[model samples]
Target: MEKTFKFTPEEFRTSVKIIQYLRTAIGSSLENHDEQKVRKYIHQAIVAGHVHRDVFGLNPILTSLQTAQIAVDEIGLHRDGVIATLLYGSVANDDDHEEIDQLFGENVARIVMGLAKIQKLYEKNPVIESENFRNLLLSFAEDMRVILIMIADRVNIMRQIRDVEQEEARHEVSEEASYLYAPLAHKLGLYGLKSELEDLSLKYLEHDAYYMIKEDLNATKKSRDAYIQQFIAPIQEKLTEAGLKFHMKGRTKSIHSIWQKMKKQKCGFKGIYDLFAIRIIIDSPYNLEKQLCWQAYSIVTDMYQPNPKRLRDWLSVPKSNGYESLHITVLGPESKWVEVQIRTERMDDIAEHGLAAHWRYKGIKSGGQMDEWLANIRAALEAGDNMEVMDNFKMTLAPEEMFVFTPKGDLFKFPAGATVLDFAYRIHSKIGNTCVGGRVNGKVVPMRQELHSGDSVEILTQSNQTPKHAWLSIVTTAKARAKIRLALKETQVKDGLYAKELLERRFKNKKIEIEESIMGHLVKKMGFKEVSDFYKQVSDGKLDPNDIIDKYVEIRNYQENHAKEHEARSAEEFEYEGPVEDLSSQSDDVLTIDQNLKGIDYHLASCCHPIYGDKIFGFVTAGGGIKIHRTDCPNAPEMRRRFGYRIVRARWSGKGTSQYSTTLKVIGNDDIGIISNITSIISKEEKILMRSINIDSHDGLFSGNLVVQLEDTTRLQALIKKLKMVKGVKQVQRI
Candidate 1:
C-alpha cells in the first residue's frame, strides 16, 4: 500500500506561534483566551508533514502577534473579526490532523470550507491568471473579515520567507508580494501591511536597488524627522487646547514602492516625493474622524501652501474596506514636498486591520455585524461573471456610499454605485430575476440605474418577466454573471446536443465512419499531418475514401471509356512468348502478357495493346487488371463511364520487356470475300499482326476479335481507331 503524504506535528509548532502572533496583533474584541486553543489546534494539524518552528514563526509574525495581543488587551476583536482571523486560509491544504478543526469549530470551519472550494477549483483546472482573479473575488464573498486576516497572514509569511535558504526556494513568494499581495493590501486599505509587503518584496527582487534607496533615505533622516515635527507642531497646540489625547509619528516610504517609482519613472533620488509622512493618531469616535481631518488641514495649510490636487477626502466616502482618512500633500520648508494622513482612533484601527477592527465597534453585536458584512460582500460577489470581473469590481467594490431609507426615518449604508439590480439581488436572486425596473423618488427607471447616496429606491418587478441576455449586459457583479452564465450554458448544451446528434446520424447512414478511429488511419494515409485537419475534412465532407486510395497508389490517369472496352469482341486474347518485340510490329498495336503468367483475366487487345513507347488508355475488365487499349478504340467509351477512375494509362518500357499477352478485334461485313480481303491486307503487308481472323455473319453484319501485336494502350488505341475508318470495316475495338 502507498503511504499517505504526511508531515510531522512539530513542523506546525511554528504555526502555533505565527497564528498566536496574528491573534494577538489583531488585538481585542472577540476572544483573546482563544489564542492558546487556536495555537494548539494549528500545531496539532500536522497529519503527515513536518513543522518548521523557526520557519513559520519569524520576527514580524511574533511582532504581529504582540500587536494583536495589544489590540485584544485594549479594544477587543468583537465576534465576527475573531472568527474570520482564525478561520481563513485554514482549509486550503489537506487537514487530516484533527486537533485544529476540533478547536476552530463549525463557524471557522465554514469559512475554511469556502477557501477550500476556491483552492480545489484551481487545483482541478489550473489557470494562473484566472485562478488569482477567482480567488480574490471569492474571498470577498466568503467574508470581509476573512479577507483582512488572510492579508495580514500573507504579510507575515513574506517576512518569514526571508529565512529560507536562497538556493531552492520558489521565487514566487517575493513575486507574489509585488504582483498580488501588495495590490490586495492596498485594495483593503491596509497601508501598513501594504507597505511592508512592498518593501519586503522589493528587498528580494532587487536587493541593490532597495539598498540604494534606503541609503539615500537614511541620508535625509534628520531633515525628514524635523519636517514631520514642524507639521505636527500646530496640531499639538490644538490638541492641547481641545484636551484630546493623541500620539504622532513620522514614517518613510517602503523600499519596494520607492524602487518601483525609481525604475518606472526613470528617476533618481531627487524625483521621488512624499517619502516622509506624518501620522496623527487621535483617540475619538467615527464621527470625530472628519473633525481631526479638518483641524489637521487647517494647521498644515496655515504653515505651508497645500497642493489642492493632493487632497483625498476619503472620510466623506470611506473605502470599501471601511477605511476613513484625510490625505494631503503640501510644500513645506525649503519647498520640500510632504504628505500627511489624519484619522481618528477607530478609523486608524480599521486602516491597520480593515474588517478586523469590527471587533472593536462599541456596542455592535459580533455575530450580527459579521453576518451583515458577509451579506453585503456576498451581494457584491454574486454580481458578475469571470470576463467582466475587474470592471464589475471597480463599479461595486470601490468605495461608494449608499443611502437606503428605513421604515422610520433611519438610513442604511451600502457600498457606493450599487444598482437597483444589485439591491434586488442583494435582497434575493428570485427578486432580482423578477425585477424589471424600479422607481427613484416615484419615477420609473431601468433596474440597473445607479442608486445615489440619498436616493429612495423602490424596486419594481413584473410577475411574467424572465431573465434576458440584456440583463447580463447591465448587471455589474460576479454573483449575477455567474448565475446567468450557468443557466445559459445549461440551456445551450441541451440545444447543441440535438444538432450534434443529427450530424452524427447522417454520417452513419453514408457508411462514413468519421469517429476518431477511422479518421486516424485516413489522416495518417493522406499525409494531411494533423488530427484536426483530418476531422475537419470528415466533418466538412471534403475527404473521399476512393480518392484517398488512388492517391495512395500514385496511378496514372485514364480515358473515360476504359472499363467497357473489355466486353467487346473486336479483340482477341492470346498468350505471350519471349520479349514482346518478337511478335510486336509498328502497325500491330497490342499488349503481350508474360507467358509465365497464367489465369490473368485482362488481355491487351491486339488491335490496341500498347507496348513500349505507346500512348495508352485502360479498359478495366470485369475480373482484374485493366486491359491496355488505345484511346480511340470503339468499345472503350462505355467502359470509361463504368470504371474510368479505376482505369490506368499504362505503357511498357524496355525494363519490363518480358513477354505480354493481348487481343485484337477486327470487324467487317460477312461478304463472301471480306475475310480474304482482311487477311490479305495484313499478310501481303509483311506484318504478322493478324494473329487470327474469323468470319461470322447474320443478315450480312460482321464482328470478330482479330489478334495483332504492337505496344501498350495508346498505340493500340491509335491503330484500332484507324482500323474503324478502314474501307471495309464495320467497327474495331479491343477485347
Candidate 2:
C-alpha cells in the first residue's frame, strides 16, 4: 500500500532544475548513490510543505539544494558535505535525525546535528550582538564543512537581502554581516565572498556613504577608464616584448574599501588619485611562477617612476593568508599616482577566490597553506579563553602584517604592534616564559617592545626569570596571553592548595571541625566570591585564619542567643557593625595628606620622593613642617635612628591633583636615538612636565637622568615602564 507523492507543475519544474544542477555541478560525487535517493529526499522536502519563500526567493528545500551546489562548485566540498547541506535544515527542523541517519548514514547525520546546534544557538540570543555572532561561528569548529555551509547560507541571504522588506531587520543583518561574517570570510580566505558581503552591507547600513562613493565613481568612470588604458598601454607592450605571456586588466576599488580609505586618510573622494589599479597577470609554468611575477614587476617598474616608499613586495614573502602579489604606486602621465599590481596567473586566481580556488586548482585533500592557517586558528581557539578567542580571531582577520627577522635572518610574520614577548612565544613557549627582554637589531629592548619590519630580534632569557602576570598586558598575541594566564592560574591553584592545607592544620590544632558549610560561610563573610579566592588570599598572607576562627565563634554565640528572632530580622539587621567612630568638629585642613596625618603641611622629601600609594611616614622638619618619606626608602633607617621624635604616621587617602617633581635614571646600550626616544615618551604624556634631561653615551652604553614633574606615583611608574620598553633601554628606576 505505497502512496504516490504529488507535486505541482511549478514545483516539478524547480525540482527538475535542481536535479539537473546537482547532476552537472556535483557530477561524479553522486555516481555511486542511487538516483532514486536524491528524488526521495526532494519529494520528502516538498511533501513537508515548509517553504523558505520570502528571503531567498525560493523554497527552503531548493535553497538548501542551491547552497549545496555552491559548496560543490565554489568551495569544492565533498559529497558528504553537499548531502549534509541539502538535508540538514529540513531534517533537523522536523526532528528527523533517525530518518537522516537511515537514509544518508551516520556521517551526514552528525554534520546535520552540528548545524542544528548552530541554528539553535542563533535562535536563542545568548549574549550581545558581536559576541553572540562570534560564538555562533565558533560552534562550528568540529566540522569544517558546517562552516562552509553556514558561510554559503549567509552569502545566499546577503545576496537576497535587498528583497527583505523589514528595514530594521535588514540593518541588523547588514551589521552582522559587516562586523562578523565578512571578517570570518576574509579569515577563511574567501576573498570574493568577503568583498561582496562588505559591499552589500555598506549599501544597506550606510546608504548615503555608499551612494556618494558610487556617484563619484560613476562621474569619473569615463576618464578613469581612459587613464587606466593609457597608463597600462606602455607596460603591456613592454611585458609582451620581453617574451612574457600576460594579461592586463583594470580594477576599480570597491565602495566599501573606498569609504574605509576616506575615513582612514581623512580625505574626500576627489583627493583619492589611485582609485583604479592595473593588474598584470603573467602566464607561466608551475615551476616558474615566482620568476615570471618578478619579471612582470621589473617590466612594469621600468616603464614608470615607481614610488620607493609605496612598493610592497608580497611575492617574496606572501601574506599570512596566502596572498601573493607585487604592488607599486607610481607617478603617472598627469603626475597623478597610479597603483600597479603584478602577479602570475596562479596568484591571480588565488587573489580572486582565495583558499577555495587553491583547493580547486590544486586537487589535493587539504595539506597546504590553508591547512597551516586553519591549524593556527584551531590552536588559538583551543588555548585561549573566551575574550582571548575573540582577540585571536580579530588578529587573524587584520589585513596588515609585519615581517620581522630573527637574529639568524629567518623571517617571521606577526600582526602589527606585536611585542617582543609575542615573538618569543611564537618561537617557543619556554623562551617566552623565561624572557626578561630582547635585543632588537643589537639594541637592548624590554619585552613589551613593539617589533617592526626588518628588525632582527634576539631574545634575552634567564633560567630563573619567569613570566609575570603583567606580561598578559604587554603581549598582543593570543598564544602568549593564554600561556601567561594558564601559568598564573596554575600558580594560584598551587598556592591555594597550600593555604587550604595550612588552614586545615590550624583548625585541627584549635580542635575546630572544618566543614564545607563553615568554609562557605567564612568565604562569604570575608567578601570573597569563591573558596579558592579566600584560600589564595590566605596563602598570600592577606587573610588571617585566627580571624576566621574568632568570627566562627562569634557567629555561633549570636545564633544560640538570637535563634528565635533570627527569622524575623532582615539580613542587613544581622550584619556585623563595629563600634562607630566619634564625628567631632575638626580644624579646616586643605593639604592632600593621608587620613592619619591630620592638619600637617607636608611636602614630599626631596631625598626619597615618596608619592601616593607608597608606604610613607611624615617627618617634622626643622622649619616646623612635615616631609613625607617612603617607609622602605634608603634614607628611612638613618632618619628613624637619628630623628625618631620627628616621625609621624602617614598613608595615602584622598586623590591628589597637585604635581610633584621626580627624577628617574635609565640605563641601556648606547644608541644615538636613545635621547630622542626618551624625550618622545616624556612629551607624549600630557600630565608629565620635563624640567631637565641629561644623557651621556660611552663605550656602547648610555646612562640618562630625567627630572620630570608628574601628578602622582601611578603616572610616574607608567612613564618609567614606557621608558624601559624603548629601544636600547635596559632598566628604568626612580632616583
Candidate 3:
C-alpha cells in the first residue's frame, strides 16, 4: 500500500562511514569493535528490512542518519539518543524491541520503544486543537533523551521537506514544527534550533510574508553589517584596553521573531528598530564568569549612554530555564537604541543549545536551575492530570516573563501581568488560600494588584480566610488556580457529605422511610438535576432538612397514591460496566457520546464538564443509563479508586452537531463598554449563543462568568483567544 525503501550498496557504505565517524566522535565509549558491530547490525537490517518512506518520499535510512548527526553534533546528545535515532525505524513491534534489547542494550531498546509509541500516536492523525496530544507524547516518552532525539529528527525532516512536491504534507509538517517542536526547543533552551525551526515554519506556512522580510533583510544586509561593525569597533577597543579575553557577534533577530514583533507592535518592517542585538561572549574561569560579564557591561555602558530602565541583570540570578546573561540597551552610532548581551562562554553555550549543553557542562543529573524545572515537570506528570500538566508546562514555556522579589530578596519569575495573589500562590498553597492582601514596596495593595519587575512583595494572610468562589478569577498562575480549585472541591465534598448525613438523620427521626425511587422523583420534581447539587444547597443553609422532609413526605404520598409515569434514578444508581485494567483506548462497543448519546440515556457530568472532542469515558448509572466525564476530571482519581467496576469505555464517533453549554470566567479592567464589546463578539460568532452573563466589579476591575453554547472545544478555544484579544479583557478560562 505504501512505498518502502530497501537498503542498497550505497547505504551499506554510508553506514560504515557513519560508524567510523561516531567511533571517533564518541571517543573511548564506542571502541573499534563496537563500531564495527553497530555498522554490521545496521547493514544487515537495511539489506533485509524495509522502511516506509514518508509522504515527502525521503528515504528513512538517510533521514535517520541525518537526525543522528544533528543529535550528536548540534544537540550534544552523543550517546543513546544518537543511537536510538539511527535504529528507531527498525522498531515496529515487541519482538523488534526484544531484538534491539538483546543486540544493543536495555537503554537503547527503551528509547526505541518510546520513539515507536510516539510514532503510533502521530499515526492516529490527531487534530492539533486537541492540546492533550502534547501531554500524551510526554507521557509516552519517559526519558528526556527520547524527546531530544525526536526534536533532532523533526529538525532534520524540516530541513529536507523544502523541496517536497506534496504541498499539503509539507504544510502539515511545517505546522507541527512551529506549533510543537519549536516551542519544545525554546523551552529546553535550544535558542539556535528553536529560531531555525520557527523560521522554516514561517517560510513554508506564509511563503509571501517570509520572502518579504527576507528580501528586506537582504536589501539592507550591507548597511546593517556596516552599522554593526561600526558599533562593535568602539566596544572592542574598550574591552581590549581593559584586558578582557572575549569575542563578540552581532546576532540578527530571526525572521519569524521579527514578524511577531511587527504584529505585536502593529508596525511595518521599516518601523521596527533594534532589529539585532550584539552579544559579547567572554572567556573566563568558572568563578570569574560573573566578574567578567559585569566588567564587560561596565565597559560597554561607559562607551555609550545606557538606559537604566532597560537593564536586565541575570548573572546574580539566572532564568529558571538556566539562561544567564547581562542585558543593556544603549544609544549606538546613529542615535538609535542597540541592545547588548554579555555572558561567559559556558553561559553562551547553554543559551544556544539549551538542556543538552547544560547537562554536558554540568554532569548529567546535576542539580541546577534547568534540572529544577525538569523536576517540576516530573512532579506534574506524576500527579496524572493531563490538563493541569499542560497548563503548568505551557506557563514554563511562556516567552514574556517578569521577575519579582520577596521581602527577603528571594527572586521569582512569573508570566507578565501576574497579580499579588499569583505571587502568594507561588510561595505556597496555604499562603495563597489564606491570602487577604499584600504589601508591595511598603504600600498595602489588594490581591488583584498587578506586579511589576523587581517589585518587593509580602503577602498578608488571615487565619480564618478561606478561598472564595470569586478568587478563581483573581489568580493567574496554573498552580494557584489548580490549588484553589482543589480547595473549593474539598470544601464542596465535605459540605455535600455533611448535608447528606443530616438529611438522612432527619428522615430517621421523622419516622419517614426514604425510598430511593420516590426520593429521586421528589428531587427531580423540585427542579434539581443532580442529587449532589441538592446537598450542596442544603449545606449552604439555603435548604433546611425539615422543609425537605415535608416536601419528601408530600411527594411520597402523592407517588404512593398515583401510578408511576416515568423511571426514577436513585442517588447511588451510578454503575460501571467496563474492564478495570487500562481503558484508555479500548472499547467493547463504542458509545458516540458528546452532549447527548444516541439510543442511550447519558448526562454529561458537571464536575469537569466533558465537551465535544474531549477524551471521555462512560460511567453507568444505577437507574440512569450513563454519565460521561472528561478523562482529566478533577474527581476521576477518587471515582476510579472507589468505583473501579463502574467505569466503561467510550469515544466520540463523528464531528459534533449539537451545541453544549459551557461557562467562561473573564477578568479585566472595568472599562466603559467593555461588557458590550464582549457581548458583541459573542453575538457575531455564528452558532455560538450566549445564554447569560454575571458581572461583579470592585476596585476598578471586573470579573464575570459568561455561559455560552458551542459545538466543540476548538471553537471554545478560539472564542477564548478572541476574548483575550478584546480590549481590557485580561484573563479568560473555562470553568
Point out where model 3 deviates above 4 Å.
Answer: 1-4, 7-19, 31-50, 129-132, 362-370, 373-735
lDDT of 1 by residue, 1-735 (tens): 222223347534754664556545544433555656654544443332332233233332243353344323322333333443443322335462243346544444544554444444323322223333423343333434334444555665666577567523336567656666567666645567777878887777777888888899889889777777876787678766766778878877777777777888899987887686888777766556577668766866777788999899877766555666888887877778778788777777777765345444653222333234533433333431122321222223323444443222233345656677766665667777788888765678898787754455667988876566677877666776666666555544543454345445655665554443333454576777865554445444566545544442232122113323432332222222322345432233234344233333455576644445545655656766657776666666766877677766454434433323356666665543444445555554422355555545555556665666433445556666656654457777666
Per-residue lDDT of candidate 3, residues 524-584 (tens digit): 9889999888888999899878888999899877754442221232212222232233322
* TM-score for all models, in order of appearance: 0.43, 0.51, 0.52
The models' CA-based lDDT, in order, is: 0.55, 0.71, 0.76
**Candidate 1 residue runs with Cα over 4 Å from true position:** 1-104, 118-149, 167-170, 234-247, 283-289, 362-735
643, model 3: CA deviation in Å?
79
| Each model's Cα RMSD | 24.0, 24.9, 32.0
Return the top candidate by lDDT.
Answer: 3
Better of 1 and 3 by lDDT: 3
Clashes of 2: 1
